[model samples]
Target: MHQDPTENIVEILLSKSTVKQKAYRNVCRAFKELEQEAQLLIDVISAKTTERDQDIKLSVEPVSDQEFHIRIAGDLLVFVLHTNIISLPEDYEYNKSNYVADQPLRKYLGQINVYNFMADSFEFNRLNDPGYLLARLLINSENYFIVEGERQIGFMFKSISAKPLDKVDLDILIKLIISQAADNDLVVPPFPNIRKITVREKLEKTQSLGAGNKIGFQMSYQNETKS
Candidate 1:
């Protein structure tokens, strides 16, 4: 366990290439608001004391009274990056819900399941993530209310209170995600719902438009303040 929890997170998310890294990056980018709302602790302890693994798991228990439950699991070569911890060693085979006896493929299936368990957390996190500004703008338009012909359908849309998320916004919330991908490329996974989906399309849009490394206004301001 690293002395500073965020440092352990940063090390694993930024340096490690194992399976768990992807989920960690998403949690960081998508759940930054939770940095304030939730208490995040870094703990290293044995699991299977054993429905899961002899590995690492991220255990997410809700507060005394709350709206969410988040847990991420770790495997032999990976550390769970969410709330509940689940780590099992290799060569120990049980009936995974998505099992086909292909361990690597099956592991990912389980990984994705563990990934989805906290879907609500990520969705709530989305109201604060990048594309969310756009989603919110759409929601807020007086035009935000759309009437197709006679029946009310959905909301119409307009624009941001500002110029919309430009390069800097993309850098802070979007590319930071891409920079940590396994292939080191910005991408969107195939899941359709924003909550279920990884922000790969946003990655493509930013890269295509020539957005790359940059800093957030908040971080930049802090740096200047220090200097």
Candidate 2:
């Protein structure tokens, strides 16, 4: 009797890893919910602030399946939804009873990350623009989440187990993002010379743009003429 060489391949392809599938579902659901919540908040804030003489405009753009951009008061807050599994440190405080499973455990965490950058950074595609991680939603191996950084958010979920994100959780997450964005100190704009250099380079490269905006010499780049 000859064994089919493709038997193992077929079995492997058909094999279902229920735990991973569930984790992936959890991540996707949470991100989608968060996206919806953020949009609603933007609408509410825009409506309430529209009557002011000079209202700050907030814009949310979807960068990718796992990423979003929120512009508030000249700051760009990038919220990234990561689907990769993560693990908590052994030292992390949690009740083992919450994650009792038959199989040997592994730490798999998912993350919802927030980063702050200058509004013009994304506008000009500056890869090196200054930014920092304001917060993270960590989904532990047991499909529970614990938020890191941003005390307000951490405190919100401190008592709860890391479970799939729901409407309430999404709402709070959006609020936390807005809260961080409202704190102007979090985002540091690029140096004045940096902006000038970037604008100068763009003007030099694009012929359609007039030279009137050029700043004479590029302060960031050195010119060398070899003999």
Candidate 3:
């Protein structure tokens, strides 16, 4: 008995969608694991480096279903996981020169983007600040991925065709990337025209009754001060 062409097409579509959904879930799992480990690493750094008055903080926040942020030191690293599966173009260098599993004509991938966020952009809730890509993950399988980004991260996996996320080496690589990101200072003095001065009143006690101390307030500008 011949199956209906329409039914066959429907089955194919459902199968493809199922594969993509599975891929998305896998990417999410990998991301969650990475987040947990990375957060722990940052906590260790904070415990080691924080001072009496100045505390070093590292935070992780989920901005959306597909996006989250890792705030390390004073900078923010945004991680965005794309839900849609994508295929490499035929002319792409990897497609042409790399070793593929040889199972399918088109290789589908789930993508994860790592972005740098200026402190003010995230803290102040400003949308105008532009972020640049710090790293990217092309996730084909739950455990296998290709990384592309800055030298600090991209160099770790340069020799391998694809890296396994579950490997111990990946944890080390992630730690290195986070440390490098923390060292990458993104904060700077705001523009002179846009900067503002904040004034706070300070109460001072009279010195030894005879020697009077002039009570004055403190005026602090961003990274600057004038009495």
Candidate 4:
């Protein structure tokens, strides 16, 4: 006997919806854990640095239900959780891994993105300043997680874990992110690029002048191509 098409559609919808709901819930729990861990870490750092340089500032600010900011001295790291649950593409390396092969639902993920920006950008209200994407954490319904990120964060966390990320794991991840952001120094823009600003720009958008760690790399690449 053939099954009814309507019933098959409903079954598929319900199954997928259930998986997505579970993934969303897992991500929300993970995010809350991350926020708590970050706050605790900040407190520890504050206590340790009490006698250190007075200029060094550290704080965590919750921006919203799905976002927060961690300010460490000259750097600002923004963490944003995507509201949607998504599945990795079939060709994605992680999707092909044995971890996901064992259970296809593990491929579904909720993403949390981390961005790095200069603290001065926000302080000076430089809306035009660029922020770099430092890392993204992907968590599945079972709480298994992985990170795709820059520098050490990339290589160190390329593989998906069999277990959920715990407090220790989160602490290490946060420390690494802070280290990466602190180490990435801002560079002066190329002289030619900044030498020809109009009077209006100098008066109005002076603070908006592009500033970032890798700001000049693209311009230099373009110059090289033209040459």
Tell me model 1's lDDT, rounded to 2 decimals: 0.25
TM-score of 1: 0.16
Q: Distance from true position, residue 180, model 2, in Å?
A: 1.8
After superposition, candidate 3 runs with Cα above 4 Å error:
1-15, 51-53, 159-163, 167-170, 185-227
Better of 2 and 4 by lDDT: 4
Candidate 3 steric clashes = 0
> What tens digits encode model 4's per-residue C-alpha lDDT throughout 37-122?
88998888878887777668899999999999999988889999999998866777777776777777777899898888888889
lDDT of 2 by residue, 1-227 (tens): 98887988876544434455666667777777878888899888877787783568687889899998887766777888776665555544432333432332424556787777767656666554457676677554355555655456555655335454568877987888678657635322346533444666675544322211211111111111111
Which lDDT values do the candidates have, in the order given? 0.25, 0.61, 0.60, 0.78
Q: What's the lDDT of the predicted structure labeled candidate 4?
A: 0.78
Give the C-alpha miss distance for residue 56 in model 1, angstroms: 3.4
* Best by the TM-score measure: 4
Measured by TM-score, how close is model 2 to the native structure? 0.67
Clashes of 2: 5
lDDT, candidate 2, residue 63? Answer: 83
What is the C-alpha lDDT profile of model 3 across 124-223, one tens digit per residue?
Answer: 5554455666777766644466666555665565522344567365577567667667666533444673244333211121111111111112211111
